[model samples]
Target: MDWITHEEDVWFEFRGNSPHQLVPGRFYRGTVDGYADFGVFVDLAPNVTGLLHRSELDKRLESLTWEPGDDVFVQVKNVRDNGNIDLGWSIRQGENEFRGARIHDPDGEADNQPVESDKSEQTATIKTKPVSGKRRHVGEKSEPKSAAAETQSVETEVVEAEPETEETTADDESRAPTASDVVGNLEEETEEAEAESEQETEEAEAESEQETEEAEAEEAELPERVSLGIIGDHVGDHVTVEGTISSVRQTGGPTVFELRDESGVVDCAAFVEAGVRAYPEVNVDDNVRIVGEVERRRGELQIETEDLTVLEGEESEAVEQRLADALSDEARPDAIAPLADHEPVAAVGASLLDAAEAIRRAVLESRPIVVRHTATADGYVAGAAIERAVLPLIREEHPRDDAEYHYFTRRPLDEAVYGMDAATNDVTRMLEDRDRHDEKLPLVLFLGAGSTTESLDGLGLLGVYGAERVVLDAAPADEEVAGETDVLVNPAREGADARDLSVGALAATLSVAVNADVRDDVSHLPAVTYWENCPQQYLDLAADHGFDADRVRELREAVALEAYYQSYQDKRELIADLLFDADEGLAGHVSEQFRIKVEDEVETAEANLEARDVHGVTAVVLDSDAFSHRFDFPPTALLVDELHRRNRDGDRFVTVAFGTDELYLRATGDLDFRTLVESAAAKAPAAGLGAAGIREGRIEFLTGAREEALDAVLAAVAEQF
Candidate 1:
């Protein structure tokens, strides 16, 4: 939870004329230039590219979410003699992970941006091992056992071996080649030198043979093969591993082969040369024997490979069978019990099982899961429920300390419809992870979005890439989107009345199906999602969980308010603490802020409310853009929903909250947004009236025809009333 801060004194900025300014082991703020098969090329200066190899990264290279031109912090690993730079993964990524950054000085080898104070802190930095490569590059200053140090040693020996000039050198220089004796004397010198060379060569060969025999004997006495599940126990120890290669990634310094056994997967680094593939014949799915030293790099376990061999016939089959049996046992879930009983949820019980299985399977398989939901109280609760359920599984499955952060993700959607823009972003990121890191495609879960026809295009994009999709909506789902979705959870599809069912309720049940251990944590979640008309069962469940009516209201109100401010962020920890922990101090404080902000907005909207009567319906309209905080807390749509809830002047009335180009309708009865749009369009075709979203009765029209569109839409709503 601690983030590293990039103070001006600690990091360096480079403007590239030469790579000389780029000190190895020093942190340099850089921009993402591009990605390579081996590593990410970061440009500290215009031409200075430092390699952040896959082996150096905390997660798989493909798992990186960085884009071209994005500013990043990289530690200068080694600047080669040829000017090629090798970079190591900065454990502190983001100004540093509290903010989510990667940065550091190379080792204590350079002081390009040295802090004047704190000598202990500056010197005690992450020590980078000399990266093995064809060139064996090193930073400017030499450290013991480094390539540069060896080069320096060899130079010292050569200098020391040089003959010293005597005082007689002046006479010897004048004498030069004096006679035939001088030419004849070459025979004696050549013969003696040849004899010495032959004896030295023979002695050197004998020493090499002895060393080779000792190495072979040591190799024969191998350590026991360590299972990946318990590999953490053998960290910093030499061990052997037998498993099938799940994926292969080449780094600037090493080729990482992801080995998977029945227990788990771990990265095994094999280096033949820099930017070169190691074990070329050993491909993915090949059962292999690996001998390596288990080590921790960037918080993840890795094997520094000593030797690797492709297993043959009998050996391969035995490992393959073991893996298959283990996968079968691990992947399938035991019989599931719903968190709470509800008829609507019961209607889609079978699909819910399948959905839960898919989610659990993704975790077992190490595939990342991305939960996308609308930015609302119910939507946030739905996402949080899954997040809470899946995080423990991720931790249980992977030994990495940061596995939960890497494996599970929650992103908020502004609109309920999963549109192209959102889909494109997901596609780009998933493709990069797969192509770059050899990572499996992610499972995309839609909490409150992607259940309608409008989401078909977005869901279609994911389907094209073989990414699994799960959509859970309490409302009736479109047949088109349902058909495309992998696991659909919609009780309305089975002819059940789900109008009053909030997504939070469905998600709470589904989260239990994902990980039943968290049932107690999510028990009261269903009650928090409902703003009104909460089921008696859910409210009672909340009461049983120690969240009384007031507590539930405060939590819901706080989530709704917080969910709006940073409408895009998942606010993972904050939401988790609010929902699962529900610490009185934090919840009460946030809820108080929520109430104050909502009340202020309500007062402002009330002063600007304009009322008009069309037929028997009273149309309460507000120009939201003109009167409300458009960009701050309590968004226009939420404000409109809140406004419509309190101000119902008549038995049959519609609250028309219209912005410049868009409007939302909140009516007392079943109002068809499509029919309303059609009616409005017919009345004012030039206005280009259209339905944006049905859940909110959201309509969009030309800003130029605001008055005309508003008039026609109000008339249409009056007719529906």
Candidate 2:
């Protein structure tokens, strides 16, 4: 169908179509909707709303008489790249003002159905599930009943459908109301109800017996069973699969049952009403046989179940025997050797094995994994390494193509410590998943954090819920942290110098230990974690694994920039493309952005540096909130770190960047961070100054006492020097 351009002053109205059918430059009748200070929003169709700017109004906005639901005319001005529609006020308020009024349509195909009529057509089969290629109304059978019943089967429905009202007039009350008349009607209704009850009970007993006999005979017939691994081959064909239900989740459209057989696992969907749970009798761990038609939904294979019947006796035994092999084969594999002969990687070998085994066992048992890491280049590489490794294993273990979504997740923390807020959020989500989706508890893995005393409360909160925790830290760890977690793998715990090791290198080692098949994909990850002075062994591995030094820096910079924006989210595919599959030049383009943004920020910060000789030590203080890009890339901490990196002329100079209530310190020396904080707190007791952590090199103080805190900290630094 060809669309024609209409002449000027032509107007249109939308009946119930979406914005996809809308045409620009044509006037449309709409109702004034959501209010705003700048303009009023107009609803042209159910899902389409356009903003009519105040500048387009013919009269003052306050003086306009239009209320919500008032009919007005507007012309489509433009559609934004993000699908927002801009509308201009039209002077043609009445249909007679336009040259012609037509309905905006798609390809000239008119939609003439009323919205109310469409809703009414769905009433009879509203709450139903399709079985045997036919819709079966829930709570109502098709069997013939005695005509002795009332118009409605349920009392609630009867009252709602035909509400009783007093119709007697003042004069008619004297003539129409005898108690005897009311009593007589009540007696008739009571007798009919009793008979209706008796007939329904008899019919139900007979139906139940008949269904039992039919089910037994049907089972004896034994339809051919299809393996879930090959279910994709039978798309649109009805087939049976013998399995045990692993989990049940009620979605908005259907009740999805995760069915696992010896071949693999798949999902079977049965619908009843919108948001209504279907197959209520089917539960997790129940042995059953399902018959459904194979289908592909969003590129993932699924089964639309027509019938789900529980199996007992001989049938149950057969299902158990069929699934025996798949169960036994899920045992954890032996951990692989580290990628290279690095002391830090080999120091925590025992803990690495434990971490790898726990991950593999979680996959085999159909448990979900939640990874927490700081939003940094090293952190993302760490998370993505495990992410890339576990995703393929999930796909292979479960028959469903979407198994990875159900099994794995990675969340980035803005702070170095997993505070109570992050723990509460994780707990809330896991509890909801368990109660709503019947999923198992997730294994919480901390990639670079959760090994400090500051994270103790958050870790303890997870422990209360019995969530298994694994903490892999490249930083030095507190001894108490080892007691709170299931596995703590830190180079400091093994007596190795954890100062030089990056989280990315340790995580990639653990990723390979989890699955050795993708060793080549992760071989270059360790080298990308370091901006400069990367270990020789990691560089050699990167060269051997097909990533040159330039490519490694490109991947590293790209992740750092993307990680700062939306710091709490793991942009999975974007990072995956940069790290693993950047044959399409995505890395170079993003890295270029990283360099530009950082360079601009660094130049601004350098121009405003306040250099001073405080307490005989060279101190450069930067008022970060006033002079730096506080909300953009190169976070205050990262910017200060970068500033110190570029301007640390010698070992005597220390970079100090202060915000409203916090200050960051960076220096290369034998200064003890703990002693410095203690001395500062002793001098300015009212400031309440405390070191955030040694790794972050930050100090937290009261807002009112910020000046005193800075003075005290500078004096303490002199003592350390």
Candidate 3:
């Protein structure tokens, strides 16, 4: 055997093998070969030995005796060169104890001693030779065989001494030298020794045979293969194991159930009729076992049955009953009472309650509020009153001086009350009042003629205050007074009023806006309503302008279209003319570059066809004023160069549009052109031929009069071509 050593650790390898046969950090089962005061010697593996220190033995086990040939399981703690090895043997705390009998002695007792034979002495001497060098301590008990042998020798001496004593004492000296006396003494001693040896041999042989039988039995019991199964297989079919259920669901007629077990978990299902009846009691972690048929559902094995048994007993049953009662109560028509009456003052008071709640949520979530109000007496009074209620709530929620609130009122007090005149005492007084009152300064609500109009105005305030609107329906009252109130909160028929107010709906709306800001209960509100109610145009614009040039172009077109439509619908003519002029100019320039004459009468058709030739060039503009004309200017050339560079470097497709006096270009690539444009423009001037202007103009290049005049020359050549 070849051995390898790493410091105190050693491992042995067979000859011609690359890997060591025995390694450290592993436990092995072996037999005790010998023991000394220092430690017990163990045969760790075939041809390998290790030491189990006396100190390492469990204190309780140490008191019991041990001998050679005793089997033990030990961990290889360390190994050393020069054939030294260290081993440990002790059951770890919390581990299961051994099940076999606890034997304290290796040799049979005196009463059960076997008869001795002459050959046994030689064998005994051979086995004991290796252990003779180390002596047992004075207090230690003698070996079991030694004590038994001493008793037998003493008995033999007593029997032989009686015969010798019977002979004459005077002739004893003469008889000691005689052949008969010496031969007789030697023969008796030899017979006694042979008897003891024979007894020891028989006992050793019996022990060896028993060990061999045990080994054979253990080998027979070792399993050849192992398999795993769910606990339901062993337990009753309708059994339930309960814990928190994750990802619970139902499909079609069957309600699926997944129960987790110690090893893992199993999937089960119940029919619709079964599921509904079970639903009253079948909650997550109810500790119920349902008996069902084991079958496959959607390619996965699941248990299906109608029988249910609650394992948690009384507690789970009571919970199920209470849940059923609550649900039934909620389903009744008269579950909630109707409102009493509608009063303007009371409605305002109720609105203040809602406003207070909104403020509390906003403060907790660290979000701003966008309020819209009318400048009419009712608007002022309501707006002022809401501010009064909300500001104190916010201050109470957040006392930090660093806390911020922004106001985007319908119009500044100066603009609304004093107009352009700065000398008015009333305006000055109001300004002083607003400055002095922290609540008045942060009033973000706007005043308008109607609630719908007010909501619209409030939309603009959203961008300024980073807030969302929480609308409260106004109370139904006399038309004169009702029209002027902030919120129409009617107390007459509280049930219908609550339905109209929809606390859940409002919470959802505010949740969508402030979810990312709030940390607590407010964050738990569902976001479905926010997405559903978001303006389609803004959402569409955001989607199209997804931080890219294509998106930017789409956004620019949307913005320009909206502005043009809102400002002047008749500008369609201007748009068309601009597009046509830009197309003509671009055709001339490209024709001049390619040395091909573009046809005059057919220029529009030719430009469209040519644009289609370039990959990714989806839309082409013929109107110069269509926001694509600015690209033709020299200052905007850099943007075209950058775009052209990106197109060459990437697999993106490009689009060309011609504005009336300018050319517009856009490309789609992996890199974000919007961020690039923003970055480059940051170093340049705000406007007037800066990077941003160039970028905008490149996508909307403008053509000079000279270039427009050249269109005729190109047209003449295009006619010939």
Candidate 4:
């Protein structure tokens, strides 16, 4: 008889067997059907399949050379009620390797008797067997099969065996009783057996319940709650810990809860099932008690939770208070003695403390930080300073090697304002990361930018999604800018001269406040921002840190050149070498290129400068559109600064670079660009003389009102002088 295949009745018709008839812990012949990254699927019957999990393989999954439709052997580890089959690896790849035949009857008792395969009946033709009468199980050795069993298509073995003894024969005869004896004693035997079974079942259930109660009692008698700081000593021991949940992350196998107590933070892992959420009641910022055994994973200590319970009422309040108190004491600012007397510095220092605390909280919670800054030497220096301090802290907190990249990012913007373009880009990246990788939303830190009302639209977009923002700038920000951010650190907002401070100087101060150990490395950065007339206080600070003017200039120029090439990338390693390790010769080589590029641009701008007198003030104006390399290095800001330095002789002098739609301002006298632009716009409203770009010391005006705009701007400059 030949076998036939059918789609609707595939399993029963293909082999005269169904998957429901599969026996657990039994070996079966199969064919490789398909492969997956995790395991392989094997076809045992037409419609019955089983998975050979990667974990059960003696060798790597990739090492298996089997192809689809190839014959293979496997053991059925289990047959679940849902009809799922789990398979284990088999060392006996050939059918002859197995001993003991099973004579399976369709409707009768299946016995362990070697027999030949009846092709018409679809049964196994197992022939090998061991010498002993006892049946061999999986993983046991079997004796060699006789030549007849191997050669004959349908053959049976006639084995020489011992005959039954007199005692066995007599016992068998006594066990087989007559019909009269069976009917007479059947009721009594049935009653006794039923009573014994019930008694045994009752005893077993009572013992199980008692063991469960005792285990629960032991869990309830846990010792006093201990701090996570002392958890290292309690490894391999069961203990109880109470804390607030800082974060919760789900993985392929376990759910990790980041617990923060007064002492420190640790991760507790719980596994209910693969890809299933454990302790579904737990959430971030909730107070809970975790009872588990401490274990080490990937060289970091973690808790294997046996029981977890959320706290309420007084318990929750107590844990929250403890964490708050500990954070306050540990993260409070200790000293700003470096600039205490400077009221502007002191005011910004207070805000620095707040910003640092917020950043620390984000770190503790495993939230990412996105730093946005202007694409300038000042902005890059400031942004790099914070990056240096925060990276080391992130690495220390998160044990993974890629934590720095995952938790922190620094992006340089072409303009100072955080407009819709920049915000949209950031939001897209963050949302994608959250969806694809299960990452939490990030905190946006605006350094050296986003301090004007112009950025409110961009900030509002982020706020709509509950993302937080922090702004740290030296430019005087609009009053409304403070309301748009979580932490605003600007001296001008607190009544001080923003002109005297550089964003680099302010941000470096804040970076040290974030991590004090980097103070010596960042102290020199403030002095480097001043091209001339350095403040005595900042110069003294730099001198104390052993950074003279030449070394400061070298670092400043090196960073400027690098900022121009790949204006988008953070260039982390290159900038770190240039700023932190000045002796590496990288700064010298790059600074030389910076000098050559700036000198060429400056010489051209000076030659084409159109000088004029406006209301007794000497004004130097350059049509940068005609004379400058519009697409080259040393931007308009740097060009104007160098022009003012070389040409200005009197107190009332202003150097201006006119672009297509905007103007750059650099002056020798105490001229407030913010005040000048505001007053100018009021005088000539049609000229569009606005302070929109005041953060970068520039103003936008209507091209049609060129003469009126220049006159209004120069009048304000003259008045201030």
TM-score-superior candidate, 1 or 2: 1
Candidate numbers sorted by TM-score from highest down? 1, 4, 2, 3
- Expressed as tens digits, the lDDT of each residue in 1-721 for candidate 4 is 1112111111111131556677656666788765545677788876678888889889877667776678887877887887778998888786456553343234444433334556558876666544423334458576776787556523443466799999989998889788988887887666766776677699999999999999899767986578987888887888899998766776544677878788777889886644467888777668999998887643588888888989999988998888878877766567554432455777766788888877777776668999999888888888988898789888877655667998999999987989998999988988887665546788999988898888999998888877889998887787998788899988877788766778887878788887888888787788777777667777888778877777778888888889887899998888888888848488889999999999999989888998889788999999888899888888887788889899997988999898877888888776677789888888899998887676667888888887788778888888887
Could you tell me which 10 consecutive residues in candidate 2 have the lowest summed lDDT?
A: 126-135
The TM-score of predicted model 4 comes to: 0.67
Residue 9 error, candidate 2, Å: 36
lDDT of 2 at 528: 93
TM-score of each: 0.67, 0.65, 0.18, 0.67
Task: Return the top candidate by lDDT.
Answer: 2
Decoy 2 TM-score against native: 0.65
Give the per-residue lDDT of model 1 (tens digit) for 1-721: 2223333224565644577656566666788765556678787876567778778888777667776678787778788887778887665555434322233334444423433434346653433443322122235353368887776555453322456578567777777675776767777666766776677699899999999999899768888977888998998899989998766777545688878888888888886654568888877668899999997654578888989989999999999898878866765567657656788988888888788888987887678899999999999999999998899888877665667887888989988999999999999998897777667789999987898888889999999999999999998888888779889989878999998789999988988888888999999999999988998989999999899999999999989988987878999989988988846888899999999988999999999999888888887889988899888888888888888889986677888778889988888887777788899899999998988887767899999999999999888887877
Candidate 1 Cα deviation (angstroms), residue 53:
17
Report the lDDT tens digits of candidate 2 across residue range 512-615.
88888888899999999986679989999999988898888899999999999888889999899989994839999989999999999989888999998876
Superposition error at 565 for model 2 (Å): 1.6
lDDT string, candidate 3, 628-703, tens digits: 2342221123233333433332343443334344344444433233343343333332321111122122321124
The C-alpha lDDT values of all candidates are 0.81, 0.82, 0.36, 0.78
Clashes of 2: 0
Task: Give the CA lDDT, 0 to 100, for residue 574 in model 4.
Answer: 84
